[model samples]
Target: MTRENRRGALASLVRTLAVALVLLLPAPAVLADRAPIAPAPSAAGVLGATTYPLSLVDDDGRAVTIAKEPRRIVSAAPSTTEIVFAVGLGDRVVGVTDFCDYPEAAQSLPKIGGFKPNLEAIIGAQPDVVLAVRGFPAEIIANLEVMKIPVVILNPVDFTGVLANVERVGDIGNAHDAANTLVTSLRQRWDAVEAKAKGAAGRPRVLFEIDASYPGSIMAAGPGTFIDAMLKAVGADNAVAPVAGGMQYPSVSDEAVLGLAPEMVILGDAPYGQSVEALAARPGWDVVPAVRDGRVVTLSQREVDVTSRPGPRIVDGLEAVAQVVRPELFGPSDTSR
Candidate 1:
C-alpha cells in the first residue's frame, strides 16, 4: 500500500482494537433508582388534587399563605405538636415546646419552653414553619414573619376544631393523605362512642373538678368548655352550666355545688394519684349529694386529661368520660376504658 493508504489502514486498525477492548470488558452497572429524600406519602389520588400557594385562615383568624412545602418545622404548642405528628411530619419537627411530651418520640426533641416560648431558640433552629396556638403573642408571630418564617396559629375550640387543625397542618406539610386517613379513623371512633353515648337515658347531672390545686371554690367545666361538650355528647348535663355565670370554666362556692346537686362528681385530679376516698373526706363533702350517694366517679387521670386538652385525643377523653358517667350502657362486662 502507499504511505497514505498505510496511514488510513493503521488508524482503522487502532479504532477496531479499541472497540474490541471495550466489548471484552464486563458490562456497566445498572444503577437502581435513588430513594426519595423527603419520604412524603403517595397522595395524588387520596386528596383528588392539591393547589399550591394556598391561602388559609388560621384559628387565630390570620390570613396566612403557604407558597411551598415546609421541610423543617417548629411546633410551639403541645396541641400543634400532636397535630403535626399525626399528619406524619414528626421527622420534620426540628423543635417543640417543653410540654409537647406525647407519642414518646416528641419527648426527646429540643425544648423551646412551653406557652411562653423562647423565640431565640426557635430562630436558632432555622425552621421553615412555626406552629403556635391562639394565645401566642402577636409580636412574636410578627417578628417571625419579619424573619421570613411562616407561622401558622392553631387554636381548636372544640373537638371538631381539633380534627380541622390536623388537616390544616397536613395541608401545610403536604401530607393531606395521612391527614384524611387520620380524620376518617377519628370520626369512626367518635361515631362508635356516640352510638353508645346516645343510649345514656338518665341524662345524669355531672360535675367535674378541674384539678386538686384549686381551693376555696370548686372549679368545674361549664358550657362551651370541652369537658362540658363531652358531657353533653354523652347525654349528661353539666351541673355547673345553669349556674356557670357565663363562664366556660367556672369556680363555684360550696352552696352552688350543693344547690346544683350533681348525681355524679368527676375528680380530674385522680390522675395525680389523688384518691376518691380523700376527696370524699374533705370537710362537709360527706354531705355533698354525689358523695352522700356514693356516686363520685374517679377517672383515669391521663385519659381524662386528654379530653381537656382540646386535641385529637380528646375523643379518648370523651370515651373515658362516657364510661364513667354511664357504665351500664357499655354492657355489664365491658366497663374498662
Candidate 2:
C-alpha cells in the first residue's frame, strides 16, 4: 500500500476506535451526581453501641439533628404519634394532631392541629424535636426551621419500612430494648398469620373499600400500595386490577364491581363507626357476593393508612385484617377477633 493511503486508513481506524471508546465509557461527573446518598449512622447501625446520635431528613430534604434524646417531642401526624407511643416515647410527646386517637393517653395530650398543622400551636409547645411524615407543606417546614424546631420526617410506607422506623424511633428515644422486643414479638405474630394464610384452603377474592358510604366512590389498593402488599403477604387475592395507573385507585363503575364479584368485601376501619353493612345497602351493592354471603369485613382506620409507618403495630394491623379475610386460616383459637 502507498504510504499516504496507509496513513489515511490508519487515521480512519483511530477515529472509529475513539468513537467506540466515547460510547462505552461513562462520564465520571454524571456518575458522581447519580451516586446514592448514604445515611449517617445511628447507634443502631453501630456495633454494641447503646446511645445513638440522631438526625432525620425533613420534608424539604434538610437534615434536622438532635445532639441527645429529645426531652419534648411533638408528632405532626396522627399515625406518627401512635408510633411514638408504640416505641415507648409517649412520655416525651407533649402535643399531637387532633386525629391522634390511639392508646387513650394520646387523646388527653394537647392538640396542635390536624392534617395541616398550625405553626403557632406547634411552636407554643416548645418541642425539642418534631416527628412528621412526608408531604408537610414547604411553608410550614420553612417556618418550623425559622423558629429553630427540628423536624424529623419518618418514611414508613410499607411493612419493612415500618419495622425500620420502629428501630429508628427506639434508637432516637433511647428505647432500644423496647424496640428490639417489640419488633421480635411483631415478627412472631406476623409469621403465624402468614403461615395460616399460606395454608388456607383457598384464598378468597378481596375488594378493599376505602369509602363504603358511597358505593360508587370507591378507592382500592391495586399496585405499589402498602395495603396491596399486606394483602399479598397474607395470601389474599386483590380484586382490583393491577396496572400502571399510579396506585390503581379508580372510581370503579358499579357494573365493574358487579362483574368482578369479589368473594369478600374488606371495609376500611373508619373513626366514625363505618361498616360493610353500610356498603351492602349502598345503591347497586345488594348484588355483591360479599353482601349476599355476609362476608363483609370491617378493619380499623389504623390498620390501613397511606403509609404503614414502619412499626410493630403494622404487623398487628396485618394480622387483624388477615383474621377477617381468612378466618379459617387464623383458626378457631385465633384471638385476633
lDDT for each residue of candidate 1 in 93-153, tens digit (9 for 90 to 100): 8998876766578889998876478889989988988988766768888888898888888
Clashing pairs in 2: 161-310, 162-310, 162-311, 269-299, 269-301
- Single out the weakest 10-residue window by summed lDDT for candidate 1: 15-24
**In model 2, what lDDT does residue 229 have?**
70
> Mind giving the per-residue lDDT tens digits that candidate 2 earns over 147-175?
77777777555666667777777766776
Off by over 4 Å in 1: 1-49, 212-215, 270-274, 331-337
lDDT of 1 at 112: 80
Per-model TM values vs. the true structure: 0.81, 0.74
Cα lDDT over the full model 2: 0.60
Write down the TM-score for model 2. Answer: 0.74
